[model samples]
Target: MLTRIVTGLALIVLSGLYWLQADAIPQSPMSGSVGADGLPKLLALVLCGLSLIFVVQSILVRQPLAAPGIPEDDQDEDDAAFTRRGHVLAGALLAISIVYSVILPYAGYTVAMGFLLLAVGVFYHRRMSAGIATFAILGAVVFHLIFITLLGVRMPEGIWPNVLAFLHAHTA
Candidate 1:
């Protein structure tokens, strides 16, 4: 709980700094409705809100604070279990991330990110479900729109470009 609160507070500070820097962005006459700093400021605000929520949620959970540098014999069951599980959980996340990076060029950003999200969801929930699948797909689509459509970044195409062209031609 303390760790969560501290992390949240740190994030809140980081977001505030981000917002201040974003505010320095100059407005352009040709800028659209959102403007140059719009997305950055919005992201900072969202980060601040999330950080506040994290701090509040951590406080609400109210876990007993564990003392640091406790002797191995004095360590509690919860701490031991968490320590034991941390390696496995971190390993799973790292392995999945490696796989994502390896397959990204072949799978494309959208598909690879969707797979990553799905894998993370499964890791956290310990099961596969329709809701996780939907979230992964929707999240991937939103990311694709933000990076590819709005920002006009050139990502590894794999099959996406061909697929998009086919859809566009058919729709037209």
Candidate 2:
């Protein structure tokens, strides 16, 4: 509970900082009514709200009645395994994030995002399939349309422009 509260407080501070940074973004004439800062500000608010809820939920939840009696002997082993798994998963996710950032500029948003989704999905599901591939492709396309086409953000073109040029030439 103390940890949860502390984490929530830290998140609140982080969200405040994020909101300030978002507020600092310069206004552009090309921006929509919501402006470029809209999304970041909204995200910061959402994070703060979620953190508050987390802190409250942690405080309200009662401790597990001392397991109703004597604890099982495997408890320590189970905790150790759980902690180890958590660390491994955290490390794996961090590695994925780093790779995504490194590749984003060269791969373009669509391709890099697809790779991120596929990699994360495979990591969690522990398997790969046609379904995952389709999801990744479709997800990337949808996100590309939302952020680039609709929002008009100037994301990296990377290898996609060349591919698109070749395809258009062949088709034409």
Candidate 3:
């Protein structure tokens, strides 16, 4: 319940800030159907609604916070251990994100994102294998297809100019 309240409150505050930032975006001279702020504003509104729902659900829930198989004393210890593990995992992911941001410009989106995905997969599962690399590369390609080809968004070309150029030419 406490977790729900904290998460919901944080989401609400963040969503409000995002909405304001989106609203601050200037209109384009040659505007199409949706303006620059359209998707961000809509996403913020959705986030706000979800946050309110979380808050309300937290308030309404009345179940006892006890594990069926564990004693109360052990349960507390388990919770503490779980919390510590969660904090460590969060820190690791944050570090990965910082590293990813620093290297993204140098490596380009496809390679950087593939590395990020593979790192995350390995971190969570505590294993690295050929499948991870295959999935990571596939994920990056799908992201490129959707974001670049379908959405017409520009991605960093970096070291793989010929690869991107070939893909763009064939797709176009």
Candidate 4:
């Protein structure tokens, strides 16, 4: 299938990039045994290997490569069930990701993620009260668990951090 071909090509490109960058990475201060580029290089090598396997499998199987499934020019009644608004919502979600990336460092992960969640809920026609409540709790917990706890990445301390500090001071 065309997907396999694209995946193979992408893997090849990624492997090349990793191989090229492996030599340029500086030594990591936290882990002196491994360089900064070590993880990427390993990932690239794995991707290359997997891609090669896929390519060979496709060839051996003799399966004809086909492009992604595109619907015929005639719009079916089932297709009409999906509204333009659905597409708009999808586009909005994508835009929110782009905006979140830009705002994350300055606004902090919690705030940016909170706003993104609320925006998505609103786009999908959820009520404001329910959306805000869900967004606040879910966004904060998920982002914290993923980026802070699991990934061991430090997120910026924006307004929410100050609010937490204030609460702690008051409680103590």
| TM-score against native, each model | 0.47, 0.49, 0.47, 0.43
Q: Which ten residues in a row have the lowest lDDT in candidate 4?
A: 65-74
Give the CA lDDT, 0 to 100, for residue 94 in model 3.
95
- Give candidate 2 misplaced runs (Cα > 4 Å): 1-82, 162-172
lDDT of each: 0.90, 0.89, 0.86, 0.76
lDDT of 1 at 24: 95
Q: After superposition, how far is residue 84 of candidate 2 from its true place, in Å?
A: 2.1
What TM value does model 1 have? 0.47
Worst 10 residues of 1 by lDDT: 69-78
Count clashing residue pairs in model 4: 0
Candidate 2: worst-modelled 10 consecutive residues by lDDT: 72-81
C-alpha root-mean-square deviation, each candidate: 13.2, 10.8, 10.7, 9.9
Give the lDDT of residue 136 in candidate 2: 93
RMSD of 2: 10.8
User: Which pairs, if any, clash in model 1?
Assistant: none
Candidate 3: TM-score?
Answer: 0.47
For model 1, residues 32-115, the per-residue Cα lDDT tens digits are: 999999999999999999999989988886854456954433356767546657878778889999999999998899999999
Task: Tell me how candidate 3 scores on lDDT.
Answer: 0.86
Using lDDT as the measure, the top candidate is 1
**Highest TM-score model number:** 2
